[model samples]
Structures are given as C-alpha cells and as structure tokens.
Target: MTAEIFATTPEGDTVEIVTLQNGPATARVMTWGATLQDFRLDGTPHSLVLGSPVFEPYRSRMRNYGAVVGRAANRIAGGRAPLNGATVQLETNEAGRTAIHGGSDGCGYVNWSLASHSETSATFTITLADGQAGYPGNLALTATYSLDDEGALTLEITGTTDAPTFCNIAHHSYWNLDGTPTLGGHTMHIDADSYLAVDEHKIPQGGPQPVAGTRFDFRQPRAITTPQDDPKLDHNFCLRLPGTEMHPACTLRAGDLQLEIDTTEPGLQVYDGSGLNSEVPGHGGVPYGPHGGVAIEPQKWPDAPNHPDYPQITLNPGETYRQVSRFHVTRI
Candidate 1:
C-alpha cells in the first residue's frame, strides 16, 4: 500500500489516496467518501473505472461517481418506513419525497478515517451520530478494500448501530472497461430471474417481479443498449431467496476486458451511465457524457424496510451489518 496526499479540501482537510496493487490489478482509494478513484489492470494502462481528473468534481458534479453509499444504499418510499411497528420519517433528499442514499448524511458525502493499510488492503472507518439524517442510531461504519493475487478486488462493509436502524451500504464504482466514450457495447449477464418494479421516482412499487417477459432480464449475456422508454437501468435485481450467503451476481464485458461481480447481498442494482452528462474532464483528458460507464451496486433491496415481503435491512444494537462485494477482472 502507498499513500499520498491526493488533495486538500476547501475546508482545509487533507484527503489521502491509497494505492493498493496485487497481481495484475491496481486500485486507488480516496478517504473522501471512501471512494475508489481509479482501477486498472496489467494489460490495459487505461483506467477501468470512470473518475474525474481533479478532486473538486467529486464534491460537485460527480459526487456519486465512485463513492461508498449508505446507510441505506437505495431509496425508501415517501422518505419513510416502519420500524418496530412505528413509522419513521426520514430526511428527504430526493425531490423532497424520498430518502435516496441516506440523504446528505450518507457515507458518500463524508470523509472516513483510514483505520489500517497494507500492501494489498486498506480499511476506513466513520461514525454517524444518532438521528443524523433523521435516522435512529449512532452508527459505526467500516469499509475495507482488498485485492487478491487473482485480480479480485473485494469491498467489505460492516456497521453496528446503538439503536435499531437501517444499514445497507454499497460501493458505487462506474466501470468503463474499454475507457471509451460510451458503454453501449458492453455485454452483461446477471444471475437474477426477478427484479423490483419501481415508480416514476424510481421507488419500489410492487414486490419482486419476474424478469422473464421484461427488459430487466439478463440471465443470458446481452448488449447493454439503453431502452427507449427509460434512459437506462437503475432497478434492483433479486439474486437470492433471502437468508442465503454470498453468491455470484453479474458479469460484464467490453472488448477484451471483463469483470465478474459477486456479493453477499440479495440485491444488485445495475445503473447504466445515462445520467452522467457532466462536461467535467475525466481521467486521461476524456470528456465524460452519457453512457460513459456503468455502476453495479450490491446491497439489500430498495425500500426493503417498508415492504415486509422483501429482505429486511435492519441492524439493532449489538448486531452487526455486513455486506461484501467482489470484482474479479480478467483479460479475455
């Protein structure tokens, strides 16, 4: 592991970026948002993940580009959910109707303290005050990134709350295997046979729906072209029967580069970069726009706290919340 001062925030806080290399993969992680700034492989000098050229873009235009999002990674309908037989209204951050990514208090918006680091691993820790973002709990969160000899990058998220609260964290990395202008040619395969149906606001509507007759199906490898109705995908696919362990979720390929994603979570949200039209300069002086990358986030189902039928995402006192996601890259 190698650490350097990446940038000094406007608040006078110095942010550090740690580089971890193992085998054919190298990853750069930043303290701010515990973000994955860059990822590359041996054969390709080009970065496999989309990132801004400078640090300021991350605080403004590209806030979610490569951050660790939480305390609930997805949306909660009406910005509210029932906890312990009572409704808990959260602080709305998405158009004042839903709590998306834990609002301003999400882990992605804050800096984390580097707990430890080694040649192939690094761990970060952060504390969320009780009632912060209108959630009940003084949460202690930790995220660890590790790279194995086989070019597998694993992100393990763990949290414990003093009170009962939601804890569903996700690492949001926009991958562009070819580092091209778009991800239209990337082929994707997900192990899920069902997906959650969302409303116009991208909040969960009904329970899990079969992907057999829907465009959400990705059981077989297929090109990830954007649909005409919706700009791109942002729905959660159910991968487990609830009460299962870690398993393979999806695989993505672009040209000679491929990534296999496996996670312990039950849901995987695939977001094609249709909304990333920022003119900010990306790495290698590339101008990022729509379809520049794709984000595959693993977490508990969106709005699971409200829907009793869905997998639960509650973390009580003394109980730890844990989720692990691994990305195995290969040159094909």
Candidate 2:
C-alpha cells in the first residue's frame, strides 16, 4: 500500500489517500468518508468509479461519490423510527422530510482514522457518539478494503454499539465502466424478484412488491435506461432475509468489461444516477450528469426500523453488525 496526504478538511484534519494494488487492479481510498476515490484495472484506460480530483467537490457537490454511507444508510420516513419502544427523531437532511444516509452529517461526510494498512488492504475506523445525529448508542465502526489476486475488491464493515440502535452501512460507489457521460448502453442483471415501493418522498410505502410486469424487473440482463415518464431507479431490490452467507447480488456489463457483485446483505439498492449532476469534473475530466454512473449498494432494507416485517437493523450491546461485499471485474 502507498499512502499520501490527499488534502486537509475544513477542521484542519489531514486526509490521507491510500493506494492498494494486487494483480491487475488498483484502488485509491481516502480517509474522508472512508471513500474509494478511484478504481482501475491494469488494462482499463479510465477509472471504473466516479470521483473528483480535488477534495472540495467531495465536501460540496459530490459528497456521496465513492463514500461509505451511514450510521444507517438509505431513507427513514419523516426522520422518525421506533427504537426501544420510543420514537427517535433523526436529522431530516432530505428536504426536511426524510433522513438519508444517517442524516446530514452521517458517516459518509466524516473523516475516519486509518487504523491499519498493508500492500493490498487498508482499514479505517470511526466512532459515533451516543445521540449524535439524533441516534442512540456510542457506535464504533470499521471499514476494511482488501484486494485479491483475481482482481476482486472486498469491503468488510463491522459495527458495535454500546446501546440499542439502528446500524446499516453501505459502500456507495458510482461505477462507469465505459468512462462515458451516461449509462446509455450498459446492461445490468440483478438476482431479485421483488423491490420496495416508495412514495413521492422516496420512503417505503409498504412491503416488498413483485418486480414482474413492472419496469423494476432486471432478472435478465437488460439495458439500464429510463424513459422520460418511467420512474427513476432508486429502489432496493430484495435479495432475501439477512443471512451470514454471501450470495450473488448483481452484475453490470459494458462492452468487454463486466462487474460482478456478491454480498451477505439482504438487499441491493440500485440507483441509476438519475439525480447525479455534479459541477466539478470527475476523474479524467469526465463530466458528470444524469445517469453518469450507477450505484449498487448492499445493505439491510431501508427504513427497517419502522417496518416490523423487514429485516431488523437494531444493534444491541453484545451483538456485532457485519457486512461483507465483493466486487470482481473481468473481460467478458
């Protein structure tokens, strides 16, 4: 692993970017948000993920790009959820109606400490105080990124809380395999039969709904395009109930390159970057607009705390929250 000071945060904290290489892949990870700043293959000409060259954009216009999001990832309706027999109110960062990615100052916007590093791996750790962002418990979180010889990037996240609280973290990386301005021609396949139905506020309205006979279906490889009237892609595809074994989640292909993802989480959120509009240029001077990339996030179901039927996200004092996801790319 090679490390360097990337930039300094507004609070005078120095941010470091660690570059890890193994076999045919290379990834640049920064301490800010425990973000994966860049990722590339040996034969690829451009970075596989979208990122900014400077730190200012990450803090301003591109906060979620390649970042580890959450104390709780995704949306919570009305910024409220039932916890320990009481309603806990959280920071409503999304238009004052929804709590997104653990609120406005969630884990993705915080600077994490580099806990350890090696030639092909790095681990970052952060601690969230009890009641921070209106959530209970003092939570200790760790994110470890490792590369294997077969060009697989594995992310393992573990969390422990001192009190009962919600904990669902996810690695948020926007992928653009062709280095194009949009995902116009990319094809995707997800191993899911149902998806959550949401309301105008992007909060789940009910339980999981079957994807058959709907535009949400992607069981077979299909083009990742949306018409003007089609609903934008930003829903969680339910894989199964939370389990310990890793399972194949999805796959994305662009010409000769394909990315395969496997994870232990029960749901995979596929955002088609319809809301992406960045003022700053991405890596390699790529302009970012709608559908510039797609974010495939593996985590527990969104708003799990409010829905009794969904997989519970409550983390107790003695239990540890763990999620392992692997992304492997190949020339197909």
Candidate 3:
C-alpha cells in the first residue's frame, strides 16, 4: 500500500490517491469519497495514462473520475418527483430532462472525508446536511475501497437516510483498459435478458424489453461499438434482478484487460462517455482530452421514485441501505 498526492484542484481539496498493489493488480483510490482513479491488471497501466500525442489533457473530462456518485446515482426524471407519497423536489441539471443522480445538490460534489485506510482497503464516509437537497432527512454515506489478495477491486457503499429519500449509490470510473481514446474496441456483456425502453429524454418509457430482438443483448458478449449498437451509449439498463444480496451484473473488457463488475443494485447505467469532457481537467493533476475513460456505473434505475414497479432506490428510516460493487480484474 502506497499513497501519492494526486491533485489539489477542487480548491482546498485533500485529494489523496491511495495505490494498492497485490500481485497482478494495482488500484488507485482518491480520498474524495473513495473515488477509483485507476484499476490496472497485470500492470497494463492505463488508470492514469496521459501525456501522449493523440491523448493530451483527457483526464479533466472524468465525470466521477474515480469517485463515488450518489444519494441517487442516475436521473430522477426532471429531478423533481414524489417519493413515498412525499413531494420531494430536486434541482434539474441533466439537460432539463431529469434529475440525474441526485441533481446539483447531489453527492457528486460533496467531498466525503476519509474514515479509515490501510494496506488493502480504504473507507470514506460523509454526512449530508439536512435540507441540503430539499429532502428532509439527514444522510450519512460510506464507501469502502478494498483490493483482495486475489487482485480484485471491491467498492462497498453503506448509507442511511433519516427521511424518505432515494439512496442508490454508485462509483463512477471511466475505464480505458487499452490506454487509448477510442473505446470502439471494448466489449461489454450484461446478464439481463431485457432493457427498459426510454424516451428521447433518456428516461425509461417501458418495462423490461427483451434483448433477444434488440442490440441490447450481451448474453453472448460483444464489443460495445460493434456496428449493432447505437451511436451514443447512455441508457439505464434494466439489469438482472438483484435478488437479495450482492451479485454479478456485467463483464466489461477493453483489449487485454477485463473487469467483472458486480453489484447489489437492481440496475446498471452503462454510459458510453460519448459526451465526457475530454476537455475537463482531471485529478491526475492534468487536463484530460477526449474519451479518456468509459464509465460503467452500477446502481438502481433512474427515476425509480416515479416508477412504482421498479426496484426502490429510496431509503427510509429503520432501514439500512447497502450496495456493493466489485471490479474483479483479470488478464486475458
């Protein structure tokens, strides 16, 4: 276990990138909510690959950059919806369409303090101010980053909402296993048999539709950019039913590197990073150019507050919310 000063860009930020090396895997974690900076397998080393000719200043565009995203990880469908019969309104930040993740008041910006850190795992915990996002309940969120002796990256989130509010936490890390901009070569396979149909606003419009007849099916495993897929990959997949505990959700691979992402959440949002700010300055202490990484976010469905049939993302009192996502790295 080793630590390096990543950057101090967020202004008065204590961004610590903790590196954990176990055999063939090396992972970098930021104290800012335990964000995953980079996860490398067999020492391929693209977690923070920059300073190249075609790829200069691409790290800045990282949305989560390697951090935990939550309160609600996806859209709230206009950012204003009712939860548990209570009219909970949120700021609309996602193209005037939905309340993505949790909104501007969402946890995306909050700097969760590091609760603990050690050789194999690091834990980050933060408290959400009351009336912070129009929700009445105070919240305490925790994310634990751990790398097992077997070379797998584990991210576990535990949070409690005092009031009735949605609480689906997710880690947003853009992955570039090949260490290249163009992710057209990466392949993705999700276990579910169907995906929810969405409207133009990127909001769910229909129930789980079979992947059997659409390009959404990945049961056989194929490249994400394989001609059959749509140009922009930004839709909330009605992932495999999260039965009772943590389970396998999808397998993502780019060239020689592969990541097995598992979560306890019922759905996963696989963003293609089509609009990722290649121009956004990243925490690698430099500017990131276009397509630096691909974000495979595992969480409950977006706007679950409105969809009664959908799995609940809201956390109420007397109930403890727990979602664990594992990024098991393998060299192929």
Candidate 4:
C-alpha cells in the first residue's frame, strides 16, 4: 500500500490517499469519504472515472465526484421519516426541502479513518453519533475497496448501528471510459425492466414504471445521449429487492473499453451528468461540463424509508448492513 497525506480538513482532521494495485489495475483511494480518487487500467491512457488532482475541488465544487455518499444515498421526502414508531426529521440539504445523501454532513463529505490496507485492498471506517444528521443510532460504517488478480475492483460497505436507523450508501463515480469531453460515444445497458418514476423535485412518486417503449430503456446497449435526448435521466432503474447474492446490474462501453458493474443492491441510479458544469477542472486539468460523464450508482431505492412498498432502508441494532459491488473493465 502506497499512502501519503492528501490534505487536512478545516476541522483539523488529516486525510490520506492510498494506492492499491493488482494485475493491470491501480486504484487511488482517499480517507475523505472513503473516495476512489482515481482508477486506471493498464494500457488505458486516461482515468476511467472523473477526479481531481488536488483536494480543494473535492471539498468544494466536486463534493461527490468519487465518494461513498450516504447514511441514505438518495432523497427522502420532506426530510422526514418514521423511525422506531416515531417521526424523525433529517437535515434537508437539498433546497431545504429534502434530505439528499444523508444531509449536508453526509458520510461523503466527512473525513474517515484508514482502518487497514494491503497491496491490493484498503478499508476506511467512520462513526456517526446518535442523533447526528437527525438520524438515530451510533452507526459504525466501513468501506473497503479491493482489486482482484483480473483487475476487477470490488467495493464492500457494511454498517452496524446501536439503534435502528437508515443506512443506504452508494459509490458516486462519474465515469468517462474514453476520456472524451462528453459522453458522446458511450453506450450503456442496464439489466432492468422498470424504473422508479419521480416528481418535479426528483423524489419517487410511487411504484415502478415499465421501461419498455420509454427513453429509460437500456436493456440493449445504446448511446447515452442523442441530439434528441429528452428528460435527462437522474432516476433509479429498479433491479430487484435487496439480496444476498450479487447480480449483474449494468454495462458501459466506449470504443474498445468496457465497464461491467455487479451489485447486491436493488436499484441503479443513472445520472447523465447534465448538471455537471463546474469551473474547477478535473483530473489532468480536464474541463467538466454537461454530459462530461455519467454516474451509475447502485443502492437501495430512494426514499425507501417513507415507502413501505419500496425496499426497506432501516438498519436495526444487532443486524449488520452489507452491500457489495464490483466494477470490472476489459478491452472489448
């Protein structure tokens, strides 16, 4: 493990970036948010995911670029949910209307501790106190990133809370397999027949909607964007209810490079990066703008706490919450 001090937070917390390698793949992970700062595969000329060389952008403009965002990965209606027979009000970070990504002080924005590491794997841990972020529980969370001999990257996250609370985490990485200015030539395929419908506020309305005959259909590999693309996606594609076994969720391809994602989660959130205009540059000083990359996040359904019909997001005491996801790239 090659580790170095990345930066210090204003709170006087130290952050470190660690490098792990196996076979043809190398991943640089940081303690802040347990982020995957950069990922590179041998023979590839550029990073597969968008990132920054310095920590300033990550702390400011590019908060979620390559971090594990959570407590609750997506939105919660009105920032309120019923927990343990009582209603709990969470921090409404999104427009002061909804709780998005566990509120403003979410795990993604906080500094974590480097627990352990090997040459090809690293684990980061953080603890959220009871009543913090308006959630009940003293939750201990761990995020581990590992690489296999075949260059596949695996992310395993686990949470155990002293009290019942909500726990849904997602890796937020904006991927651009070709290093292009935009996702013009990228094609994607998601193994989902339906997706959640959202309101104007981007909150789930009710049940799942069929993807057939809709622009949301990506059953077969298709270009991420066309000139006539409508309803820029920031929605979740329903995979299945949470399960113990991992399943293939999606695949993304650009030219000869391909990325395959498998996860144990139930939903895949596909954000087209339509809102990603940033003055701060990305890795290698690359300018990030609309369609600069696409974020494919696997997690539990959004607003699960409010919708009893949706997959549940509650983590009770003595029960361990676990999510496993793998990202493998190959020359296609």
Off by over 4 Å in 1: 226-231, 241-244
User: Where is model 3 more than 4 Å wrong at Cα?
Assistant: 3-5, 9-11, 48-60, 242-244, 280-292
Give candidate 4 misplaced runs (Cα > 4 Å): 240-244
lDDT of 4 by residue, 14-87 (tens): 99999999999999999998999999999988899998989888887889999999999989999999987899
Error of 3 at 129 (Å): 1.2
TM-score of 2: 0.98
Ranked candidates, highest lDDT first: 4, 2, 1, 3
Model 2: per-residue lDDT, tens digit, 1-332? 78999999779999999999998999999999999999999888999999987888989889999999999999998889999899999999999888899977899998999999998999999999998889999999999999999979999999999999999999999999998788987999998999999888878878999999888889999888857537889999999544549999999999789999999999999999988989778897856999999999999999998899999899999999999999999998
Q: What is the TM-score of each candidate against the true structure?
A: 0.96, 0.98, 0.88, 0.98
Show pairs that collide, candidate 1: 1-119
- Collision count of model 4: 0
